[model samples]
Structures are given as structure tokens and as C-alpha cells.
Target chain A: MIKVRNMTVAYSGQPIFTNLSIAFEPGKITGIIGPNGAGKSTMIKGILGLIHKQSGDVTLHSKPVAKQLKNVAYVEQRAALDLTFPINVFDTVLTGTYPNLGLFKIPSEKDKSAARQALADVNLSEFSQRQIGELSGGQLQRVFVARAIVQEADVIILDEPFVGIDMKSEAEIMSILKRWQMAGKTIIVVHHDLNKVTKYFDDLVIINRGIVAAGKTADVFTKENITTAFSGDLSTILFSDKEPEHA
Target chain B: MRSIGLFIDGLMQYNFLQTALITSILVGIMSGIIGSFIILRGMSLMGDAISHAVLPGVAVAYMLGINILLGASLFGILAALLIGLVTLKSKLKNDTAIGIVFSAFFALGFILISLAESATNLHHILFGNVLAVSDNDLITTAIVLAIVLIFVVVFYKELLITSFDNTFAQAYGLKTQLMHYALMLVLTLVTVTALQTVGIILIVAMLITPAATAYLLTNRLSHMMIVAAIFSVVSSVIGLYMSYTFNWASGPAIVLTAAVFFSLAFLFSPKQGIIFKKKIN
Candidate 1:
């Protein structure tokens, strides 16, 4: 479980998030829904202690999140990676184990075995030796997921993991998250698609600059809440009772 | 046949040959290690500029009768730090800032060399005479190469993470700026140390060729460093032999041998090389 209290992040005197508070419970898939530049990624980064939060505290399992790097795993957006580095699928997944291994020691046989098992979980065992650059977008995303699995952390934060991925990969990722939730891991995913929130997320944290609403997905998916969170204009277009095509 | 045997005997007895071999190896190791990071960060041109910019530092030091390595390292470090800071702080692009600093520093060195032509042999400062390498220069180069290698290995993870994704590394609580400056410092020292053997015109080849060849052969950073170091040592030895046999400049001969390795890597490396084509079907 993760607890964020009165968190505010700023960059160059401009506040990215102000007076935000939310809790991500264990054993549930929590989807963070927001418009572009609405501080969703910043919030996740703040919790992971990746950025300097102007004022706030993020706690994981009753300890400061900053001190618990080993307890958390992160899957960055695929767009942020360099695909031409010549790293293979296996090596890419093995990097997730680095924080645990520290600086000096090499990856042991156990670590290699764990990486292989993680690949197997994603049905990518056959592709372990393939060059990362040769993989498709969906396969790359799955490789990142395999890395997170190999990390075996208590909480996993994925930033826009589904972006540019096909529907099958997206569904495959959601199923994996569902299984992770069942195994009692806290999952926080930054998502853009409003349509899939009801189907995939058990808890929804709708954010626009700050926490607009945070609770069960079914209760928070109301037309009024959607409209309020997205600033009424776009929400009306998405949640309108009548199809716009008929009009 | 009798005259040739006498000439060979004289050549074998010269102390300069031993000095050249040791100096070239030390310079090769330093340049190869530092050059790996430079090429990885896409700062090869910056390395070239810094190497050239040290010419004035050497010229000034020779004029003042000071240690050339110390003087040139001080200047190179200053230039490198200034370039890094300016690029990070200002809106000016990195390549443009490098161009400006490189041209200005090199031009200043040329002017100083022209002024001090009456005091010393300026041509030696420019092209360098490997046959004239002293014990002191060899000792300094060896010390510098060892220091550079140790520092790189000790800070391997931090350097790798920072070089790969600076913003992410900073977010993860690593000191991105400090690491950046540290790499620049190492690069300056490496450039200065290499200048004793390779000179400014050929220093870039020594710095970049081994690393570029290693890059074509390996994907892992640690493995790449090992491969680069091996390539550099072999090329330096081969180059020295060619220089001795053909009666040519050691610096160009070493660089030409390294270039041959690079061309071989390009043509025959397993994954990305032109000759080793991937199965696309």
C-alpha cells in the first residue's frame, strides 16, 4: 500500500501538483486517469521518489517511499528508451534487478534464472535472445513488464505502458495486472484511454492538476464526475447520452 | 647485406624505441577508455576540439618551462567544464558551443606558438617527436592512464546510468551534474596524456577508433571497454612496428593501424556489420 499526503511538486517555480492526497491500496489495480500535462506522471514519479516534491510525503508499507527503492518497481514508457543500444530481450529485463544487486556484483545464476522465468510468464521465453531493436512495439512493452516481474517488488508503477500498443498487448497487460492484484501487489498505472477504465481498473484516481476524485471505479465513472474532471467540454463529447455520429 | 645488418644493430640499440613503445601503449589505453565514453555520449567532435585546444596550453607551458601535462590538463579541463556548463545553462546548442570554444582556444594556442617561435621549437608542440619522448613523459602518461581506468571502473554503474538517461538517473537520486563534470574531467586528462604520443591532429583517431570498433563488436558496456582496450594496445604495437620499418611518423602510423581495425569491424562484425547481413526473411 502507498500513502501520499499533501504532495505538491514544482519545477522552476511553477507548481505541477498542489495539495494532492491519495492512497493506493494493496490487492487492487489503480488507474490514474488524466488529460495531457495534468500531473499524472509527476504524481507517480513523486511517489517513486524520482523527483523532488516541493512539499509532501509518500509512504510505502509504513516506511518512506524514498527509502524503499527495493520495494518498488517501475516500467517507463517505451518511447523513453533507446532501442538501438544492441541490448537483447534478456539483458534488458535483467537491468531491473540492478538496484537489488547494487554496483559491484555481477548478475548471478539465480538472477538469470529469475529473468528467464519472468520471460516465460509473458510467453516471451522464445524471444529472449532476440535483439531489442528487432521487436515490435507490443513486444517491447511486454519485455518491460517481464523486467518488472523479475524485480518482484511489492508495488509496481507503470507510466503509460499501453501507449502505442495494440489491443491484444493491452489486454494481455491488463490480464497480467489482474493476476498481480490477486497476488496482493499494489499496481498504479497511468492511463489515457477513458473507455477501458471500467473494464480494467478496480480503483480509479481521476486527476486534473490535482486529485479530483479517488474511489471505486464504478462509483467514480459517473457522467458528472467525468465531466468535472475533464473540464466539461471534452467530457460532454465522450459521455454524451446520444452518439455524436447520429447527430 | 653487411651495411643492412649494421643499421639494424644501431636501430635495436637506440633507447628511443623502448621509450616509444611504452609511451604509445600508455597513451593508447587512456585515449581508448575515455574515447569509449565520448563516442557513447556522441561527443567525439567535442573530444577532437579539446585535443586541439590543448595545443596552446602545451605551447604556453613550453614557453614558461613548466610541466606540459599539468599545463595542458588545466587548460583542457577548463575548456571542457566551460563547454559542459555553458551547454547545460544556456540555450545555445552543445555542438555550437563546442565549435566556439574549440576554435577560440586553438586559435589562441596558434597565436601563442607564433609569438614564442623564437623561444622553442613550435613544430614539436604541433606534430610531437615520439623519438624524443623522455622518461618523465612516459611516467606521467602511465600514471594518468592508470588513474583514468580505475576511476571509470569504480564509477561504472553511475556513469552508465547517467550516460543512458540523465533525467531518469537524477530522478532516481543520483548526482547527474556531478557525474557529468567528472566525465569531462577524465576526458580532459585523457586528451592531455594522449597528446604526448599522438599529437593534436592524430589524437582524435586514437581516442575514437578503438571505441568505435569495440562498439561494433559488443553490446555490453564492460565488454566493450575490454575489447576497446585490446584493440588499442594491438594497434599501438602494430603502428609502432610499421613506423620503425617504414621510417614514418609514429602517431600517423598508430592511427592508420587503428583505422584498419575500425574498417575491419565495420565490414565483418557479427550483428551490425555490413558483411554480416541479418536474415530479414
Candidate 2:
């Protein structure tokens, strides 16, 4: 489990998140849902120690996060990646083992096998040798997921993992997360799709510049809570009767 | 032909040829490895800019009687760090920052050169004389190259991940800022050493051309690095020969040979070459 306390993050003196506090439990799939500019990604980065927090501490299973780096793996938004580099799928996936290998040592046969298995898990085993630039957006996202899986971390954090992916690939990725949860690995995902929030997530943390609601998916997703968290107007449109509320 | 034979015999007998070969190889290998990462991260322009900026550093060192490599590396790293900071901290685009730094530093170097025209051999620092390479320069190049090679090999995985997906690598607890600074330092040292052997104008060609060519030919970093090293060493040898045979400038000849390789890669490389368009129906 990971814990964040009184976390505040700012960029160039512009405050994004202030006094945010939350805990992501172990062995559950937790969805972070919020409208655009809601500090969802910022909170994730703070937890991962990618960005400096003005105030607050993050801990992983009672250890300082900096000392427990190998316990967590993160799959970033696909948009943040450069796809034109001359890297193959296998090499990309193999990079996930870097933390464990540390500096200087090459990947062993065992690491390569784990990478292959991770590719197989994502149904990308056949594309191991293929150039990453030659892959579709969905396939590229899956490759990143395969990398996270290969990391074999206790916790996996993914930022908008399904964005721009087709429906089939989305379903495939959701199933992978379900399996990860089944395997007792904690999964925290930043998601924009409100429809899948209830179906896929065991817990929900609605964030808006700070922590808005933190509880079970069903409890925190109530109409009143959703309305209050999303400023009421957007919630009405999102929860309209014509649109099915849950996927 | 007789003159050519006599020149070859003279080169073989002189210590300068051996010095040039050793120095060129050191510079080439360092640039080749560092250049691969620079191209991978799309920081080829940064490499080019840093090479130019080192001119002021070398000028100042020549004036102060300091070690040229030391002064150049220090200033180059400072300039690179400043560029990185500006790009990361401010809203300025990376290329714009690089342009500003390179122009300002190069102009400063020119001013310093003019001020000290009577006291220094400016050509040795500007377009270096490989034939005049001292033992100390060789030692310094060797040390810098060895350190750079070790760092690259040791952090290959981290570098690969960060270059491909910096956000993800950072999110996974990689110290991406530290990695970026470390890489910039290595690149600065590589460029400085390369400038001493190949001159500032041609250092960029040596830094980027081999890697770019290898990039066209391979889809793997490891293979690309190997091919780049081979290409760089070949170009260095051929350029040396051309320079000796035709009585042309060594720096321009070396860069021209590398450029020739780049053109060949552009024309004949299998996957990304212009001549071999992907079949899309």
C-alpha cells in the first residue's frame, strides 16, 4: 500500500494540488477520476516522486518512497513518449527490468524470459522484434503495459492507459488490469472514461485540485458526491439518462 | 605517385601520425557513443551548440594558461547545463535556448580571439593541428573517453528508457533530471575532445553523422552503436589518408568523409532510406 499525506505540488509557483491526502490500498484496482486540470496526473507524479512536492510525504509500505523505488512501476500517458526511436518491442519491454538490474549489468537470460512472458501476456509475443515506430497507437500502449508487467512490481500506476485506444484494446487492457488485481498487485489508474469507473475499479479517488472523495467505487460515485466534485454542471451531462452510466 | 609514396613514408616515420591516429580514435569512439544517445533523444542540435560554445572556454583557457580540455569541458558542461535548465525551467523551446547559447558564446569567443590575436595560435584551438597533439592531450582524451564509455555502458538501460519515455521513466522513480545532466556532461566532454581532433565545425558531423547513418541501418540501440563506432573509425582513417594525400585540411576532409557516409545511408539504407519507400497499399 502507498500513503500520501498533505501533499502540495506546484509548477513555476503556480499551485496545482494543495494539501492532498490519500492512501491507495494493496491488491485492488483504484481509479483516479477527475475532470481536466484536476491534478490527477500531478498527484500520481507526486506519489511516484517524479515531481517535487511543496509539502507532504509519500511512503510505500512504511518505507520512504525513494528507498522503495523498485516496488512500483508506472506506465505514462502514451502521448508523452517518442515513438520514432529505433527500438524494438522486446528492447522496450526489457527496459522495465532496469531498476532491479541497477546500473552496469546487462539483462540476464531470466530477465529476457520474463520480458518475453510479459509480451505474451499482452498478446504481443509475435511482435517482439518489430520496430516500435511501426506499431499502432493501441499496440504501442500495450507495449508499455507489457513493460510494466515485466517490471513485476508490487504496485502499477498507469496514466490514461486507454486514451486513444480502440474498444477492443481497451477491453484487453482492462482484462489485464483485472488479472493484475487478481494476482494481488495494486493497480492505480488515471482514467477519463466515467463509464468504466464503476465496472473496473474496486475503489475510487475523485480529485479536483485536491482530494475530493476517497472510498469504495459505489459509495464515492453517488450522484451528490459526483455533482459536488465535478462542479454539478458536468456531472449532470455525464450522468444523463440517455447515456448508460456504467459500461 | 612518387610524392605520394614519399609522403606516406614520412607520415609513418613521424610521431605525429601515431598521435593523430590515437587521438582521432579516442575522439571518434567517444563522439560515436555519445552521439547515438544525442540523436536518440533528439538533442543533436544541443550537441552542435555545445561544440560551438566550447570555443569561448578554450579561448579563456589559452589566455589563462589553463589546460584546454579542462577549461573546455567545464565551460561546455556549464553551457549545456544552462541550456537544460532554461528548457526545463522556463517556457523557452530547447532549440531556441541552444541557438541563444551557441551564438552568444561563439561571439564571446570571437571577441576573446581578437583581443588575444598577438599572444596565441588561434588556429590550434579553432581548427586544431592534430599533428601537434601533445602527450597531455592524448592522456586527457583517453581519460575522458574511458569515463564516458563506462558511464554509457553502465547506464545504458536507464538512458534508453529515459530517452524513449522520460515521463514514464520519471514516474517509475528514475532520476531523469540527474540522468539528463549526467548525459549532458558526458556529451560536453565528448564534444570538447572531438573538437581538439576534428575542429569545432566538424565535431558536430562526427558527433551526429555516424549515429544517424547507423540509425537508418538498424532498429536496435546496441547494433546501432556498434555500427556507428565502425563507421566513425573508418571515416577517421579514410579522412586521415585523404588529408595526407591531397594536402587538404584535415578537419574538413574528416567531416566530408562522414557526410559521404551519411549520404550513402540516406540513399541505400533499407528501412528508412529515401530510395526504399515502404510498400503501403
Candidate 3:
């Protein structure tokens, strides 16, 4: 299990959240959904130690995640990467193995083969030699996904992985996540689409600066919880039978 | 062509010619390797800032009777550190921070130069006179080159990962802060080594142009470094030959040769050349 205890997260001295606690069960596909400015991304980054948390304990199996960052694979938002950098996709994917390779060690042939296999799994085997900038948005996302697969991490965290991606790539990524779940790995994703939340995730952690509800998708993904999460203004549109993107 | 051959032979005959040729080539190779990272990170302005930022240190070193390279490297790193600090502490963007620090250091350099007018020649420090290479200068350049080369080779993967995606670097426990400082240290060392050959005014061009030209030609970082190094060596050799034959200023000649190569690459490179791309209907 992954546990976040009594965490207070702040950015530039402004508190985003206070006394927040959440637990993620093992071998589950978890979605963190929230409105804008709700600290959805901030919460994940805080857990990863990418952002400073004012006070918190984020642990996996009762140990701090910071001490075992190698056990985690993270794919950041697409906008966070430099697409025009002069590195081929193969080299980019190979970096996933770097944390495990440790200091002053190069990737071995086994590692290269593992990276190649991950690329093949993502249906990007032929595009390994292409520059990252030449790839379409969906293809680039899959490339990063392939990198995460090569990491062989116990916990995989993806932020906004489906935005701007094609439906085919989305299906492919979902299937890949399913396969990882079958292997008993933990998958945490930050998502925005309310329509697919229950269909895609087994567990949902809903928030709007603080946790509104968190449990199995069927139990916690309710009209009242979502209404409270988005506030009174969005409740009508959110509960409307037809799905619009949540605010 | 005959004059070129005679020039090569003449270069072989004189010890000063040999020293100037060897030092310029070394400076060219080192600059190309380090500059590959600079252009990739889109830190061209930062490169310019650090190169110019070393000026005050050089002037101060002259007054204090200290080794100019040591002083210059310290100030170069100080400039980079200050630029990073300002960008973090304030809302100013990187280029704005660069502008503020580089111009201030450059202005301070001029003021110090005037104060030390009797001890140094401003022209030599500004444009460089490559033919006046001292043995100690040669040794210092060589040592700095070796150190920069070794670090780049040893940490090539870490550097690549950090430069490509620093957030991923941080998430994966790559010590990106340390990688950044290490790169800044290498940049300072490269600027210090190029001080006597390219001088402060044109050192940034020497650092950026070759790598940028190679970037136009290749899609891979390793190939970029190799192609840039080759371009650097060829341009340095031809520029030195031109300087020897025509009595031209060596620094401008070298930089101009590099610029010419960049122009050619920009116009005719098969992959990314602006002029040669097939137009859409």
C-alpha cells in the first residue's frame, strides 16, 4: 500500500492543501480527479517529492518513497519535455533504465533489449530511431509510456497522459496499464474526463483542494461527492446525464 | 593552393606558428564539445553571459597579479550562479536575468580595465592575439581541455537525461541540481580556456556556432558532438592559415570561418536547412 499522511503542500508559501491523508491500495488502477486549481497534479508531484511539501509523510510499504525512488516510474505532462532536443526515441526510452543502472554505469545489452521490448509493446518499434519532435502527440506519449515500461518500476504514475492523444493510443495505453495491473504493479493516473473515470479506474480519489471522496470507483464516484468537489455552480452540469468535461 | 601549401610549410617552421595552431585547434575541439550541451538547452544567451561575465575577473586578476584563468573561471561560475539565483528568486525570465548580470559584469570589467591601464592591453583581452601564446597559457588550456573532456565522457548519460527532461531526471533521482552545477562548472572552464584564443567578445560564437551547425546536420547528440568537433578543427586550421598568410586578426578570422561554415550548413543541410527544404504546394 502507498500511504500519504497528514501532508500539507504549499507553493511559494501559499498552502494548496492542509492535513491531507490518502491511501492507495496495491495492484489497483487509481485515478486522481479534481477541478482546476484543486491540486490534482500538485498532490502527485508532492508525493513524488518533485514539489516541496510543507509537512508530509508519503510512504510505500511503511518506508518513505524518497529512499526508493528507483521503485517508481513517472511520466510527466507532455508540455514538460523539450521535444526539439537532439536525441532519438531509442535514447530517450533508454533513460528509463538509468536510475537502476546507478552512478557511473552504462546501460548493458540486457537493458537495451528490455527497452526495445518496451517500445515494441507500445507499437513504436519502427519509430525508435525517429527524432522525438517528428512524432505525433499520441506517438510521443506512447514513447514515454514505453520508457516507463522499461523502468520495471513497482509503481507507475502518469500525469495527463491521455490529453491530446488519439483514441487508438488511448486504448493501447489502457491495455498496457491493464497488463501492468495484472502483474500486481500499482498504477496511479491523473485524469480529467468524468465519462471514462468509472469505466477505466477501479479506485478514484476525488479532490478539490481537499479530499471529497476516495474509495472504489462505484462507491466514491457519486453525484453528491462530485457536486461537493466542483461546488454548487458545477453540480447541475456535472449530474446532467450527458457528460461534459468537469471544471 | 600553392600559397596554402607554402603557408602550411611556413607554419611548420616557426615555433610560434606551431603553438598558435595547436592551441586554437584545442580550444576549438573543447568549445564544440561543451557547446553541444549549451545549444541543446537553448542557453545561447547564458553562454554569451558567462563568456562576458569573466571579463571583470580577468581585469581583477591582472591587478592582483593572479592567474587570470582561475579568476575568470570563478567569476564566470559566479555569474551563472547569480543568473540562476535571480531567475529563481524573481519573476524575471532567464534572458532578462542574463541581460542584467552580463551587462553589469561587462561594465565593471571596462571600469577595472581603465584602472589597470598601465598593466594590461584592452585590445588583447578583447579580440585576442593568438600568435602571442605563452607556454604556460598552452599548458593551462591543455589541462582544462582534458578535465572538461573527461567529465563529459564520464557523465554523458546523466547529462543527456538531465538536459532532455530535468523533471524526469528529478523524479528518477538523478541529482539534477548537481548535474546543473557540474555543467555550469564545465561551461566556466571552457570559457576560461578559450579566453586567450577567442577572447571574451567572440567566445560565445566559438562555443555556439559549431554545435548549432552540427545540430542542423544531425539528429543525434553523439553525432552532433563529433560533427561539431570536426567543424571546429577544420575552421580553426583554415582560419589559422588565413591569419598566417594574410596577416589577419586570428580571433575574428577563426570566428568568421565558423560563421561561414554555419552559413553553408544553414543553406544546404539536407535534413534541416531552411533554403533547401522542399516547399509545400
Cα lDDT of all candidates, in order?
0.81, 0.84, 0.89
lDDT of candidate 2 vs native? Answer: 0.84
Write out the backbone clash pairs for model 3: none
Q: How high is the DockQ of candidate 1?
A: 0.30
The sequence of per-residue lDDT tens digits that candidate 2 reaches over residues B164-278 is: 8887676666788899878877877887788766788778888899999999998888888888888888887777777777766777777889889999999878777777764
Candidate 3 lDDT over residue span A1-247, tens digit each? 7899999998878889998999987789999999999999999999999988889899988899999988899999999888888889998999999989988899999999999999999999999999999999999999999999999999999998999999999999999999999998889999988888989999999998889899999898877888888766566665676445444
| TM-score of the A chain in model 3 | 0.95
Worst 10 residues of 2 chain A by lDDT: A238-247
TM-score quality measure for candidate 3: 0.95
Cα error, candidate 3, residue A247 (Å): 27
By DockQ, is 1 or 2 better?
2
- Per-candidate iRMSD: 3.0, 1.6, 0.8
Where does candidate 1 stray beyond 4 Å?
A5-15, A49-57, A61-64, A231-247, B1-11, B52-75, B102-122, B165-168, B245-247, B267-270, B274-281
- Expressed as tens digits, the lDDT of each residue in A1-247 for candidate 1 is 8999999999878998898989999999999998888899899888877778889998988888777676787887788776766467898788666667666766799999999988988778999988788888998899989888877788888999998988888877888898899999999999998877888899999998898888999888766778777778777776676345446
What would the TM-scores of all predictions be? 0.84, 0.91, 0.95
Off by over 4 Å in 3: A231-247, B279-281
The candidate that wins on TM-score is 3
DockQ of each: 0.30, 0.66, 0.82
Give the better candidate number (1 or 3) by DockQ: 3
Error of 2 at B150 (Å): 2.2
